[model samples]
Target: MVLAVKGTEQEELQSRDRAPQSATVSPTTGFFFTSPYRSLSTQGCFAKITQPAADGDNLQGAFQQGVQQAFAQARQAGVTNPVLCGAIPFDTRQPSALFIPQQTQWFERQAFMASVKPTLAALPTIVRQSELPKQTQFMQMVADAVQVTGGEQLEKVVLSRLLDIETSKQIDPHALMMRIIAQNPQGFHFHVPLNEGALVGASPELLLRMCGSQFHSNPLAGSARREADPLQDRQAGERLLVSSKDRHEHQIVTAGMRQVLHGRCRHLHIPAVPELLSTPTLWHLSTPIDGEVADRAENALSLACLLHPTPALCGTPMLAARELIAQLEPFERGLFGGIVGWCDAEGNGEWVVTIRCGTVKANQVRLFAGAGIVPDSSPQAEWHETGTKLSTMLRAFGLQG
Candidate 1:
C-alpha cells in the first residue's frame, strides 16, 4: 500500500535514521485507534471540541464533516498536516473515535516490527470464559439469519458472537498489542483507546485504501480453519478456493463493493475469480479490487464512510442485513466490525475490516468473531468458523485457541 504523501514526505520517512526524536511511541500514550495500519499510526485526542457525530443513523456525510472540523481544529492547534486515526463502530449512527497525532512518523511495518518484540509483564490469567450466545444459541442465531428475509429476499447476513473473559488481573493494552503482533505478524495491527477500554487486534481484511485518487480493497467472506499438517492445510485452502457455498458468499461481498464503487470510480479492476488468502489460523476466499476515483475531492475517511460495512463485514443489501443482525446478535458490535485505519488530512490512507479483534478493559476482555450466512449456510459449520476466527485474539492472551 503506497501512501500519497503530500509534503516533507521523503525527508520524514528517510530522516528518522537522523530524525529529531522517535515518534514511534506506542499509541498508548494519548488517545486510542481503530482500523488496520499498513504502517504504524498514533493520534492524540481530537482536540476536545472535535468529537465525532454520535447520531447513529446518518451515513458518512455527518461524520466526514466532523472529521474535517477536527482537522481544521488540529491546524488551529498548530499541528502540521495532522492525521486522524481510530475506530469507527459497526453501527453507522455511532460516533467514530479518531484523533490527530501530536506527531507523525512513518515506519516500514516489517523492519520496525523486527526491532521490537518485548513481552508482556504478565499475561492475564483467565478466571472464566463465557460465550454470549453459547454454542447452541449461536447455531440458532445462524439458522435464524439464514431464514430471515427482513421483508426482502436476503442474500446474506454477517452474524457475530461474543466471548466474555474474566481475568485474574488487569490487562495491559500495550503488552497485549505487542504480543498479538509478535505471534501473528500479519494484517493491519492497531491499539486504540476508547472511552473506557482499548481496541486492539491484527486485522487481515482491507476494507478500503486511498492513495491520491487511487483506491484498493480486499474483501474476504468465506473461511476454513488451518490444519496442523502442511499438506492438509494446503488441501484445505484448495478446497476453500473451490467451495461452491463459499464462492457464493464471497461473491456477495465483491458485488456489494462494485455496487458502491461503480458510480464513483472512473475505472475499476476486479478478478473474475477469487483466490485464497491465509492467516495464522484460517484460510479465506479473497478478491482484490482496485480503481481510480473520478475525483480526488474526497479524503480517505470521507470515502470510507461510503463503503464501511461491505457485504463481507455486514451482508448484501446492507440495510436488510443490518436489520437481521440487530434482531439476532445479543451484544452491541461497538467497533468490532467497523472500519479501522488512518487517513491524513489529504485522505490518503488504508483501512482494514476490523475483524480478528477484541476490546480490553481492566480485568474483562470481550472477543468477537462472525460468519457470513447465506441461504445455504449450515449452523454447525458457521459456529466452528467463528471459533476459528477468535483464535487470533485468544492466542494473544497466551491461550491456545
Candidate 2:
C-alpha cells in the first residue's frame, strides 16, 4: 500500500501483497480508519498521539490539543482535511489513542475492495467460544442492580459480556472488516489498526456527526433480536415499540442527551417518540436529534466528549451508573463501549458508539455486547439481548451461537 501526501510523490506504507495477521491492530504503531457512508478512507500515519492516562474531566481539552498537533504536522505535508481516528476507553481515565493518516484515498463504494479478495482457506476457523460473564454471573449482576441500589440511585446501567473466540489461525483484519461491511452496508463500519491487533465493527448508533455548525445524533437504546420468520420478526419489532420497559429505557437516553445538548445548541429538535431501526440481527428504538450549535469553537470532538458514555452506553445519573458498571463488569471495556470515528481541524466529523465490536489479538477474537438494565429489566431477557447483539459480529466470522 502506497500513501502519498497531497503534494508529494507516492510513498509505500506497506506491501499490497502483505496481509494483516490479526483484526485488531496496535494503535501505537499505525492504523487506518473508514466509514461506510464516506467515500474516502485514510491510511498510514502523519502524526499520532497517545494518552496513556487521560483525565475524565479534561478529555475534550486533551483531544483538542492532539488534533491541533496532528493538523500542524499534516499542514507541513500540505494535506487538508487530514483524518484523525482512534478509540477511547469506556472509563475516560484509561489510555486512548488517535492517529492522523498521512495519506487519504477515495474509493468507489467500499474502501477495502482489493483487500477482501483473500480466499476462504486463509480464513481462520473458530476452535472454541467462551462467554466472559457466564450466564449465571450476568444474571446475578442484573439482580445486584436492584438488590444493592433499590432501583433509585441507579436507574439504568449497561452491563456487557465478552465472547472469546479462539481461532485455528490468525484472522485477517481486512477480510474480517470487509465481511462486516458487506453484511451491513448501511451501518457505520470502522477498522483501526493497533500494535498487535485491530478494532473492527459495523455500528448502527451514531454518537454524533458535525458538519460545520449543524450537527446530528442518532441514539439507539431498546433492542430486540431479529427472527428468521418474517411474521415473527415483525411481531418482535412491534413488541419492542410498545413495551413499557423498553420505552422507559429509551426515554432515559433521549432525555439525558437533551440535557447535555441544551446549552451547546442554539436550537435542538428531538421527536416525542422513537422510531424502529433494524440491523441484520436486531431491532432498535432510535431517535434522531438535530440542532445547530451557537459556539463555532465547539467542534465535533468537543461535542462528542460532552455527550459520550450516554445513557445508551453508560446509563442514567451518569456517575452512579458508572460506579455500578465498575462493580459489576469483570472486564476492562478497552474500546468496546468507547467512541470511533474521524474529525478534521475544522471540527467536522462523525463518531459512533463502539458497540457491535470485537478486539482481535493473535488468534483470539473477543467480541463485546451489552444490555441496558432498568428497574424492571429481566435477567434472562437481558442475557438473551446480548447474545442477539453478538450475533452480528459472530456471523461475520462464520460462527453461530
Per residue, candidate 1 scores C-alpha lDDT tens digits across 1-401 of: 11112232322222112323355556466443323344654433434322443431233455566666766766665566777777778886665666555555565665666678668555978999999899999999988887773336688999999999999999877788778878767767777777688888888888778889988888888999999999999999999998999999999888888888888879999998999989999999989899988766766666677787889888978888888899898888988899777787777887777888888899999999999998888999999899889988998888888
Ten-residue segment with the worst summed lDDT in candidate 2? 1-10
Looking at model 1, residue 370 earns an lDDT score of 92
Q: What is the lDDT of residue 106 in candidate 1?
A: 61
Error (Å) of candidate 1 at residue 88 is 0.8
Q: What is the C-alpha lDDT profile of model 2 across 225-340, one tens digit per residue?
A: 88899999999999999999999999999999999888778989999999999998889999999999978877777888788889999988889989889889998888889888
Which ranges in model 2 have alpha carbons more than 4 Å from their true place?
Answer: 1-39, 52-60, 108-122, 148-150
Give candidate 1's error at residue 139 in angstroms. Answer: 0.8
What are the RMSDs of all candidates, in order? 5.4, 5.6
Model 1 TM-score is 0.89
Model 2 scores a TM of 0.87
